[model samples]
Target: MSGETNRLLGMAKEIMAQPDGRELDMLASTGEQVSVALLAIALQALGKQAVSYAGWQVPIKTDSAFTKARIRSIDDAKVRKDLNAGKIVMITGFQGVDADGNITTLGRGGSDTSAVAVAAAIKAAECLIYTDVDGVYTTDPRVVSDARRLKTVTFEEMLEMASLGSKVLQIRSVEFAGNYKMPTRVLSSLTDPLTPLAEEAASGTLISFEEDKNMEQATITGIAFSRDEAKITVLGVPDRPGIAYQILGPVADANIEVDMIIQNQSVEGKTDFTFTVPRAEYAKAVEVLNSSVKAHIGAAAINGDTKVSKVSVVGVGMRSHVGIASQMFRTLSEEGVNIQMISTSEIKISVLIDEKYMELAVRALHKAFDLDSAK
Candidate 1:
């Protein structure tokens, strides 16, 4: 697949032409279609009654967004009927069609989201995700040698971890599963699927609601980190009402997401505002803020750094716990790591620091929180 995609892209580059989102989507969707057809063929060869359905055939409806379409609804009648008829129904995972009958593809990690959406539409018992890893780990196993696989994790924790850059599950899919109250399991595709379904499930990590007993045992469920962050600061802005909006309006209009915002106290009626955006959007965000935003909002200068990282500790038990924040600060301080910006929610606390300290911060925090062992 990689070779094929590279070849396709190389040809496009040679032609000195750029493919629009719609064309890119159309081309990218063929990969999933091919996989579904091959899988269906393999199933039939194994003596199973099997059939393959494209997204348009199953009718996974999504918005008109060409490359990053969002699923609006799905028609499950075909799949249901096929299942009742004792035939396996295989649907292409990521691509869908809009109302105008235009092909659309979801962006990165869309396949996982598509699977969850289908499960939700059909009211399945659970959605099992077959990935390269057997289960969610306390941290990236390659980074932390002692990282342990979790038996179960609350949806809140999983959502936070995913948003904080844990790649075990896609953040949108986790949110969809949570919204539909669907049980999800993470299992490895490298393992033999012939294992009894029940036994196989036990070997994976179950994502459940916070009311479960297992969810209340840990204040910090795991450590998540991402290096794809950049910080931007708008300095010397008047500390008047709606200043935040004045500074961030253009950024939002440009479709750039702002994360980990900090507004310092007014100093001589002026304040320094700092925030973070995805590294890819760093230049665009800075440009948006510097062009008209600085003058309109009465700001002095704009500064940005692309070499920043965010690390977070996430858990449902955080709600009932105390001293977790202080302990986190102390742990990082002991490591001689300086925190740049901080953001917190009910389930997570994320801090931005120099990118160079990302791994050291994760390892230190993991050890400090005792995340290498299961609760």
Candidate 2:
């Protein structure tokens, strides 16, 4: 159990005045309900009324997928009735039900989703998310030591950052906050509890819908890297319509997510195609493609490489700027870093470089973007 979980549990016990009480757990509808119940007891000690409720109890309805359930609607009347009756609701995040009434959970980090849902249901003025980090930094502090904490961040920029992989806040939570127009504060729970609430400054990032013009913009927002990638090569597929589909169909059926695909024109009426997928699914994808598509396309062979990483430069400012990608490529070239593949979005640019060059590449790009400088 984490310290925060333990503290909440201890607080629940103190408030309840009973070692064991009827607690509701709003868990991920997966398993975090155990932690919720434990925390309820801790809340009791602090003289705060507490109860843990699962997504089913709070009945956060959504689609029936167990791991990545999407919430459909919440019956807030029951929640409001409980809160009005003096109950501190500890509901689970990440799982809900569907019209057919099946248990589903939002994917990973759904706990943040649960927090925002509860806040919105109760119309709380602010939703404070306590995490390990003190707050949101100008850039990832681990990458840029001088990365300063932002008092606030706009919803759109934060969404782009989170989607690009700033794990401080879940993308869904930010979306929920923006939709509800709620002010969400991300704080570190590690701060001293004895300090006055006002004096206990929030150390992490605060995400809101408004932007601060006074806050100078950094050319790059942060550095995000992912190693969960695998490259796939399909040799000698006929140059024709639906060939790409015929090749990728089985991989999709096998639930492998393909990324960064490239198909070159056929040489002598036979073309070569390549793409990437999650490293874990590499074997399955290759197996399916080799077994099914290979014979159909007269493919010579299927090849897979799991030892690759995608490092990206993310910033909303890039939308208005030119030469960002060129500068990134130049910096990597100057460092003798060879890029294997490349991908880009309006707000982000990602390149697949040698895994060995991951850190060196990130540092070079960070410096090139002037992210290490104080704004």
Candidate 3:
């Protein structure tokens, strides 16, 4: 799939100076289009009536954001009609069309988002997401061998984990399911072809709205880590009102998202500000600030580190638990992992750490929280 996108990208560059977002989405969406067509063919060969449709065909209307489009609404009438006619319907994921009839794509986990959105639109009983891994784990299984497959996780915890780095399901999909109270399951696609329906129904991780009574209120439900983070610091800025906006406004104007921001206490009326961005946008963010913001704010030099990563512990128990923060810091400290910045919410605690210690930090946190199934 990536090979196809890359080939199109190369072709575009050769044929034109640079590919615009509209064409980029037009090119990228073909990947899903091809898959749906093949699946429809396979089903037909198996003696089942089936049909495939693309986003524009269904006219899944989206805002005109081009590559990063958000689904405004999904017209499920066509899918329902196909299903009513006794035909299996396959709809392309990750791509939608605008009212202007321009093709757009939801960024990153857009396919998962598409699936959930469609399920909600059709008011399905549940949405089953089949993926490579069997289900969501306490952490990346490769980093922590004993990471447990959660039978069920609360919707909120899953949201935090997905945003933090538990990539079993993307955060946007979870958000969609949560908003509409949709029951979404993540199960493996590798199950036996003829697995019993009852058994398959009970397998995988169920993401629900706190509907699982057996879910333990573990202080740390999971350890989440992401290496795709970069930190930027603006030094020696006046600690006055709106200073933050003065610094971040331009970055936002440039479409750079900021996360885990910190501002040191004023020292002689000046403070240092720091924040994190997706590593891919770090260079562009710095350039935006330097070009349009720095001198206007009368700040000192700006610097960034693309080698940093973020580690977070996510659980609903954090709201009522004590010592969670201290224990998390202690675990990382014992592993020689230094925390650069910190962010927190009712269900999670996030800390920026040197990229080299990311896996080490995750492993230590997993052990500290006793999330190991073998234990």
Candidate 4:
């Protein structure tokens, strides 16, 4: 698949042209279509009725954002028709069609998002997402040797974990499942094929809408870290009306997602404003500010750090427990890890720090909050 993308890119380079997002989608979508067709063929080889369909055939509708499309809705009539006929309907994920009939892909973890959306559309009782790992863990196993796999997690906590950096589930999938109150389970793709259906179904971490009272709650459920973080500061801007919008509006228009915003107190009617964006968009975001916003906003200068990372502690138990942030800060403070930025929500607390200190921060915080021993 990447070979095909590269071929297209190489052709474009020869013609002195950049690959258009639309054409890129047209090429990248072929990969998923191939997988679906092969799966359908394999199922048919077993003497089971099966059919394969592309996103446009399933008509999974989405906004025409090209590379980073959003699922607007999905038409399940064809899928239901095939299923009612006792055929296994295999459809491509990650890519969908727009009202104008153009193919578009959901960003990096689109497959999971597509699955959850389709499940909700068809009113499926539950959606199981099969991945490389057995289930969601306290943290990445490579990062923490004793990281434990969770049997179940509230949708709220999972959402925070996904957004913070847990790769077991994509953030949008968690958001979709939570929004629709849909039951989603993360299962291991490497499970034995002959395992009992009942036993297999009960395996993995269930992202449930309700907390399991039978399980003891921990103040911190997991440690999530993102090395793909970058922070940008619009320094010395006027502390007046619409200032935040003035700084961030163009950024939004550029389709660069911003996170963890901070505004310092007004000093003589001027303040320092800072926000974080994905590391990949760091340069583009800085370019956007320099060319259009800098002089207009009369700011001192635009500064950014592409080598930063975000580490977070997420848990629903924080609503009842206190000192989570204090403990987190103290833990980092003791490790001499300097936090560059801070953001918090009811169920989570995230800190942006030097990228080099990310692992040290995660290990220390994981142990400090007793996540290593958390069930």
Q: Report the number of the highest-lDDT candidate.
A: 3
Name the regions of candidate 4 deviating beyond 4 angstroms: 1-26, 100-104, 211-218
lDDT of 3 by residue, 1-375 (tens): 447666766787888886799998999889889889999999999999999999999878899998889999999899988888999888889899998898999988898999999999889988999998899899999988989988877899889888887888888999999998899999999999799978998999999776545334545679888889999999999889999999999999888888899999899999999999999998899999889888998989898899999989998868566688999999888888888998989888999999999988998999898899542
- Pairs in steric clash, model 3: none
Clash pairs detected, candidate 1: none
Predictions in order: lDDT: 0.86, 0.74, 0.88, 0.87
* TM-score to native of every candidate shown: 0.93, 0.80, 0.91, 0.88
Give the top-scoring candidate (TM-score): 1
lDDT of 4 at 55: 92
Question: Comparing candidate 1 with candidate 3, which one achieves the higher TM-score?
Answer: 1
Whole-model alpha-carbon lDDT for candidate 1: 0.86
Candidate 3's TM-score reads 0.91
Worst 10 residues of 2 by lDDT: 19-28
* Runs of candidate 2 exceeding 4 Å displacement: 1-31, 82-87, 97-104, 137-160, 163-165, 170-183, 198-202, 211-219, 265-268
Error of 2 at 353 (Å): 0.6
lDDT of 1 at 287: 86
**Candidate 2 local lDDT, 1-375, one digit each (tens):** 545544654666677764331131222243567767878889988888998887777778876555566666777877788788898878866666666656666776688987887788778877889888887765566765766676667676677667655678888888888888777888988987786776554545667766545333435666677657778889877888898899988889988888788888679988889898878888888899878889987888787778887788877667566688899889999999998888877667888876778778777787887766666
